[model samples]
Target: MKLPPLKTLPVFEAVARTLSFSAAAEELHVTQSAVSHRIRQLEDDLGESLFDRHGRRVALTEEGERYLEAIAPALAQIERASQQLRGQSDTRLRLAVPSSLAVRWLIPRLPHLQRRHPDLDLTLEMLADMPVMSERLADAFITIRYRQRGYVSTPLYVERLFAVCSRQYWMQMRESLEDAGLREKGSGRSIRPEWLSRFTLLSAASVFEKPGEDWRRWFQAAETEMPPTARVQQFSHMLLAQEAARHHQGIALSNDYMLDTASDPELVRLRTHEFRTGDEFHFACKQSRAKEPGILHLSRWLERQAEASGWR
Candidate 1:
């Protein structure tokens, strides 16, 4: 028996996979007529109808489906082998992290990685719009959430939230005002014993639904009620909200990891009361890739880094 042309196989496979001549044509950068011609040639050679046309749609025949199951993996392996032979490991490391963590933690440390591994290609994408990680696109991901039961996750750090204010604002309150006056200006027009209501509360937009709770939890832990007239300014990204807080625009409740004392001297911790959100920073990868060399190296390095940073 003679074998079909190698080129025709790809065309048939594309049409079979997509179930649309136009779709396959678009993917292959060819005309629909060309795709149809290729499939016709392949079917003539094999003496079998591969698809059942239903008006505008198409479905694979049983033989076509079985052929695809056998061919797709072989084709993929061929592509991978070709890439490997070309000395293209395709070692693209894509990391999806929260904007705050990207800004405060990862970006700062990336310089060290760059210096150490100049050949390594890394793509850092901010995960502000997409909250769910460990999806199809990413190689590794970082998230702050409650421990998931089934997935293998490594705890990078625990969240410790406290109130932060601008140093200049604190000084202004100290100089012109007594404790009572300071309390009045900080919390709200009317000062209560807790004094949290005096200042505006800066928050991340998604803080309400995030696994670790928000400012409300912190206030509760402090045994203080939220102020009635408290102003809340929401930022799309937590990093932006934190920057706003540092500039004394408002008081923000955030974790220590997100604060960079070197960059923003105006930012000062307003409260000594540390509250736990029961949520923690985590590094997660697919269970299949857990034992992969690159993944293992990254996991161990992250664990060591977290330990050195005193993340509990």
Candidate 2:
């Protein structure tokens, strides 16, 4: 019965997952000092440093990773068991999604899902890259092309990227281009594919895809030369690039999955050109759990949502 404060284990996992004390604090709804103190206590009880502190950056030590592998599943099981004991009928599923996709796509529709199925509880794990398949990390995943083999995956949508910018920026650019006689009259659009040279390009990378590849392909598909990146902005996720665009930073390339016309009315999309990459997002889960009623329900819901979104 020699156990450390059981409550502190989650604090450790949060810090390891976020890799920042401040981030972990925000996620746990506690102060940084409180998080640090809890970690100190846990390390003292374990007689080993679980995290390597390097100023603002933090990483899990070797022992920390092993400990997480051991205790995380146990914690999840305890939570599920407690729910059952309370006579709850909810079937909770942990779903791992790319960070940008969660923020731009899944989060907004969460309310609809809850209203539709109250018994299906979901915990979303935002990831910067494709996650390795593990029930401990997530019960299911939304990833690019199966990320790993052996899982049953279904196509969500083919990636279709187009140019997007703040409505105000586009208006200003339109007037300037018109005055300079650079804009074509009767074209019925404020922009042309070749006009991209006038704007900075914002690129994003995720799921092992190249950040700048879409932009280049978009230009090529339009028979326009690729614009120079004299003033380029690169982001680790599409959500950041789109946020930067919303602030009038630059024109960003984004797909339909990451956009909602009603979400950001101030953002204008140039319908002049688009690049349809054959790549698609897929809904997946472990083969062993594929037959579970909860997994089956979630998978069908996701497919229907994708279909309703006009993914062709």
Candidate 3:
């Protein structure tokens, strides 16, 4: 038995499923006349009418319906297989991340991602200082900003920022006090009452931009007044600020998620209480890419990682 033309079957399937020649044509990116002609030819080949005209609409006949049930799945499978093969050729996932988070959190987990998806070509790009979405440039993005309207955003975690310093800096301060004959100073475990008066306070540029919620804000949240004339050294980026703190350049306020204890043991948290801020960590992607498998996978993975890390 001779088989019907493969090309005609798709046209017929589209018409049969939609029951509208115009709709099928629009979906197939062809003229309505072409869709009608293909269905006519297919019916002639099969020796049966496929559609029953009802004024402006069409309905599939019993035979057409049965044929559709048989062929639709096979055609859909072929289309999906083609897409999957194309996807393998373009397996790269472009991710946009904040510079600070990239250096502190995501960079450390990259080895684990590679082990899980050896075939995935992962690319990481640092986001600009301000939050912006570019669909053409990134497949997904992570941001630490307030919710913006008109974008699909998923809250991943809330971060708490606190002061951190290097262990060496604490030891040096202890030695300096002992040498100055102030060894009788309060217990070395606790910060000296005049400690803020002695050392510089390092922070990111964001702190200055939001003066209401700077290092002084955290101090106020702890029910303490801002220290008078505390030395301030601002870095252009959060990672730089954290790095400066790690090297004992000065004390810096940072989020726990931005410190990799496994990689930098010298960094130690100074304040037990965290500063309350409105900023939140969220995942944002264009509505168009929301349903994509890769996007969904990464979103879920990040969520799980956040959960495991005890992020709120």
Candidate 4:
């Protein structure tokens, strides 16, 4: 039995949906000429004109209308079947996340996610902050939601603020415990809040695109004032600033979710109470897409990971 060129159907669907060859080409990430060629090829095989071309516009002929009505559902079924064979109804899930979370949290857990889902394809798009989801961009986003709406949001975990430094810094200060003004608390040394002025501060702007997520808030929670003349090194992305602190560059103000306690033994959290920020990490997706098998699988997996992260 003769089958239509498998590739042409998708091109035809794009053109039929948009009613413009150029638009279909842009959506398919191909040249306009390529779209025209596929349409011509498909029409030749079917022995009927699918589109009636006018000066600068095109319209579907009666044959095209009938053909599309029959094939579109079949194509959709084929896609669904392909996904089912791969273990999910939506095989590829495009997820957007903040850069710091991607580096520190998500990437590390991806191997387990892949093993569990097997056939699900997870594409992560790292952004400094979450953006609005679109068909051409991310299908979902994981970040702290402020006022953004129009999607189903599932809260994963709340982020709290803490100060961390390199283990080397802790050791060096221990050697000069008296001069560094370190105090003993229970079984560990703690830095005096006022002594913060002696060390360089590593910081990042709020990854949430809002203000006040910085060292100042951590100090404010302790009811201590940050020295006006304190030295600071600012990084655009929180991941970089956190890495700087891990490498002994300076003290960094970090969020709970961004700290990977299992892997990095070189970093030490300051012996101070943590500040709970009202913001939280959430998985945002279109209400329609949320029910898809792949989306559901990933959303559940992420929630479980968040639970294990000890921040919930």
TM-score of each: 0.65, 0.68, 0.62, 0.70
Q: Which stretches of candidate 3 lie over 4 Å from their true place?
A: 1-91, 145-150, 174-195, 208-213
- Backbone clashes, candidate 4: 0
lDDT minimum window of 10 residues, candidate 4: 178-187
Clash count list over all predictions = 6, 0, 0, 0
**Per-residue lDDT for 1-312 in model 3, tens only?**
688977898899788767899999999999999998898888999999878998877988888877876687567547656887887433467788877777778888778777776766778888766455654346678986535554687887776777777898867766776767656556545454345446777768664575324677767777787677777787765677778987888777887678756566888876346765667788887665566566676777788777777784
All models, RMSD in angstroms: 7.3, 7.4, 13.6, 8.3
lDDT per model vs. reference? 0.70, 0.80, 0.73, 0.78
Pairs that collide, model 3: none
Worst 10 residues of 1 by lDDT: 184-193
lDDT of 1: 0.70
Off by over 4 Å in 1: 1-90, 129-135, 145-151, 176-193, 209-213, 231-237
Q: Pick the candidate with the highest lDDT.
A: 2
Model 4 TM-score, all chains together: 0.70
Better candidate by TM-score, 2 or 4: 4
Q: Tell me model 3's lDDT, rounded to 2 decimals.
A: 0.73
Could you tell which candidate, 3 or 4, scores higher by TM-score? Answer: 4
Q: Report the Cα lDDT for residue 239, model 4.
A: 75
Give the candidates in order of TM-score, highest first: 4, 2, 1, 3
